[model samples]
Target: MDTPFEIFLSAPPGLEPLLLQEVTEAGFAAPEVAQGGVTIQGDWPDIWRANLTLRGASRVLVRFAQFRAFHLAQLDKRATKLDWGAVLPAGAECRVDVTCRNSKIYHDRAARARVAGAIESFGGKVSPEGSLRIMVRIEDDLVTFSMDTSGELLHRRGYKEATGKAPLRETLAALFLRQAGYAGDVPVVDPMCGSGTFVIEAARWAAGMAPGAERSFGFEALPSFDADAFAAMKAEAATRRDTDLRFYGSDRDDGAIRGAEANAARGHVADLCQFTRAAVSDLPRPEGRPGLVMVNPPYGARIGNRKLLFGLYGAFGAVLQERFHGWRLGMVTSDGGLAKATGLKLSAGPPVAFGGLTVKLYQAQL
Candidate 1:
């Protein structure tokens, strides 16, 4: 348990560099960018901290062991040699997921069965309904064993039960906030806010609250889990501090506004957030120093008509240009022409996959 292992921070595709920057700033050691995520060497406690604090990671996985196998017989022999008892708690129930590529053992189900049998040999239970997950990847004849440290998706955040149609994910909102150069120093506003995702994320980040503070992790069921130590870590996290700064959100839909308000209350940031019903044409500039105005409006693909969306984007752009002086704008949409309709001198980031549609973040100074 004292020996360091590989920790993988799964990030949304096309946002790996931003997540890498975040991990580096978080003071994790020797974080290297990978194809789908970032990899770092750490012990068990580092796993806990990564899941608890990282706002951009979609999930956390720990790679405990790896080896080469030519066939199912060889894979079973190598897997049985692993000290499963050292990692999984006695009689632990877990589900195994396997992916095979460029390997002699191309049957993923067979590999999963072999590994599951090996785990059960150590008095552990393999069940599809298990709370814990064992991840197996066999690529190029090399097999790797990993465990999902995060049971539910990290974006769940345990507080946002009320969400709007095609709502922006909290993890995506945090990464976009970072991309917009928002460091929690000033006000944040989302005029077309849905469920207050951006505003609540900004408020929590500004207040120094942990992203996973209100949630439980799958690692708690592992043999390495130290409940007392995890409690101490949570206790030592930065507490909420009173600040004059506020995060504001408004939407044309009254029901959306109500849901946003409820989300803020559940997230314990109602005092720092204000949600009201308003239209894009009537969006108000909050009274404070110029900050970030981040919004995820209807993409036309999900919530609105594509032909009618141009006028909507044009109105939003006009409002920002007229009222939001010195503020930065981050707008997300799937159509490039709609972004151009804003008539602002905006630049776009790389394409991001969201809800089966390709979206990009358009930014500019207002």
Candidate 2:
């Protein structure tokens, strides 16, 4: 049996517990929630599975090794002796990024130079523009080496080519859905659904589709990767469940509605999702059992005037309360004031970092 390596699955800050729940349900070895992500021990195949299946993870990193270095000379010597070729191929181009804190190697550039030199000595080519990345962290004199097994952030599912203003990321949308207690068994509606992120994600979840099904992963480029094994794994992960429930989305902009339709088609969930051009004031409850209504409206700082947004939110609240009975609401916004403007008694979740803005999920049962 192969020895299990430490795998770190990163989520947006303040959403680690949600990611931990996902990791646990996915049958990965006991996942421990860390400061910035979830940590688990698994073999190379588990790494591949995580990259292919986990929806909330922003990136998956393999903790390669760790060592103590008292000085620059010791760092260089220790880095040279580690077995880099076991993970990185000999001819592969790699990029090294270093961060130092409370260590003798205080200079990040100097640390990166030493590590890059050692990788070059081990027959790897160093390139700033390389897709493969090796990350080094020096904190409290303890040096930790980790390789980014996910080249691009996992949220780039490769299906969303067009986006509306201030688009929400797929990973965050998945987390929000989970936070709202959505289990893929019920309907979901987004009133101000710019680009259809929430509705599309709900449809995919209901259909048991893998978020990475249509994309490639960085693990495919590793030295120990097995293409045949990966192919078999992907085939096994295929989902063909039939769902009677439909997801719905509406946006006032015609172009946004068109883009959402295109994105759903590309995502292979057009049959399960329906998008239309309608303003929040005109949104009607779709014909189904009431489910979740999740929306990421434009934040004041990002778009539109704050004073005018209050009226928009208040109107949305009134419409939902009067029309949509037995429904749940989850709204993401940077300002609590704006969320309160909805006049709905919403309980706010922990603040999450999104695109340099701190946003919270305000949820309620309508």
Candidate 3:
């Protein structure tokens, strides 16, 4: 058996535990949660599966090599000695990003230059805008090298070309769903759905669809990538299970509803998700046992005036309380006062940094 490589699964700072749970449930062995991410050991096929299947990870990185370098000369010498061909093909375009802290090689630009020069000497073209990234971190006199196996952020999903103002990311939506105790067996409804991220993600998860099934990964360009093995893995992951439950999303904006429908179609979950245009005042519970009513409503940080949003949230809460009995609510908002204005008995989770603002998930059992 080949030796397992160190894989780091990056998530938003506050979402590490959720991501760790996802990694562990996805069958990655003994994942350890670290600051801002989760660490696991896996072979190259596991790397492909991690990118293909894990929904909460922002990116996946492979810690390919590490060494101690006392100076720039030592760094250059040690970098060149590594087998570049094992990961990067000769003449492949790559980018070197370096960060230095508490180390003799303190100049970030200089460190990047040395690593770039070493890669160039090994017949790799250094391009700052390249998709393939080699990240170098110098901490406490030790230099560590990691390759960004996920080229684009995993949330892109190669779908959702159209979105409403301040749409939620798929990764964050997945984490919030998990935090709210959604396990794909029950139906989900997003009342203030912007572009159907929550509904579509729930549908996909319920159907056992791989989040990256329609996307390409950065590791495909690496020299060590196996096309046949990856294809088999992807084929196996693409086998979807039947879902009796339907996911629902509603928005007042017709454009947003149209975009959500298109996005759901693109994500191959349109059959399982229903997107409609309806205001909070007119939102109705779908026909089923109520599961989770998750919504990322407009807040002062991204959309409408904070003062005006209070009425919107209050109306939302009123509608849910009046109609949807025996349901759970998970709402994302940056303002505690606004969440309280809903008049629901909601418990706020830890604040999560999102889109340059601190937000929390306000959950309640209705």
Candidate 4:
């Protein structure tokens, strides 16, 4: 086993570069990006820093060990042979979430049962709240075990009490903002800002606040988790301030505005942002400044009325063309046909995947 160990930080698809940049900036050397994650070598502080500072990552995982097993009995024997106490403390809440891609152990229940039984033998009970979420991949006859250091997904910033029909993940919202090259000086306006994730994330970034400052991570529950060290890290982080940050957002639904307001208040960014009820067509652009107009509109999933949303997009596009000049646009859409309804010219090209969902993050020059 490596001393400081190598950990993989999972990210939304096509966002490996974003996460890679975060790792590099956090003092990790030359992070290698993969399809859904980036691997870096580090000790406990690196893991803590990644949890606290990485704005684009979804979960931090430690690749503990790997073993070969041909059958279910061999799997159980191999699992019990490895050391689990190193990651999880005695009688800690532990659970295994396995994903078998192109593997012979295709049965999920049996896998879960085997892992659960093995873990239980060591007096650790399975719970919904598992600090250690072990992901096992059994391909051909090879098996790999990885432990999740990030307990709750980082997107659950502990602020969003009320969510919209199609809520955007907070990590994703921040990544999209960074991808747009936002430096917190330019105004960020989300017209269809359901639940205010984009605005709140922007406010946090602008304020120089730690993304996981107010929240807790699964690693906190580990035996290696040091409260004073984490607290000192947080206190050190709270010293920086971005007083000039300008963040703003709006939504047509009255309930969504209320929810956004409530959520932003909890995140301590309510005062930093402006929220109100206004249809995307009537969204007023700020005067005399080049800002970002990013939108995560309804994608016709549930309560997805495409015909009605088309007009909404047209109005938004018209506003972009007529009133908003020099404003950069970042629109997230799952449907290519629906994105065309807006009719914004593609200045920055190509759409990317987010949350295993292939959504195009397009930019338009207006």
- The lDDT leader among the candidates is 2
- TM-score-better candidate, 1 vs 4: 1
* lDDT for predicted candidate 3 compared with the true structure: 0.91
Q: How much is 227 displaced in model 2, in angstroms?
A: 0.5
lDDT of each: 0.91, 0.91, 0.91, 0.79
1-366 in candidate 1: lDDT tens per residue? 336889999987899998999999999888999977899889888999999999999999999999999999999999998999888999899999999999999999999999998998889999999898999999999999999999998998888988999988999999999998987788999999988999999999988888888889999988889999999987766367677789999998899999989988888899999998988899888886999999998978878898999999999999999999999999888889999999999999989999999999999998
TM-score of 3: 0.98
Clashing pairs in 1: none
Instruction: Report the poorest 10 consecutive residues by lDDT, candidate 3.
Output: 1-10
Report clash pairs, candidate 3: none
Each candidate: RMSD to true structure? 1.2, 1.3, 1.2, 2.8
lDDT of 3 by residue, 45-74 (tens): 889999999989999999988999999999
Name the candidate, 2 or 4, with the larger lDDT value.
2
TM-score against native, each model: 0.97, 0.98, 0.98, 0.88
Error of 2 at 254 (Å): 0.8
List residue ranges in candidate 3 displaced over 4 A: none
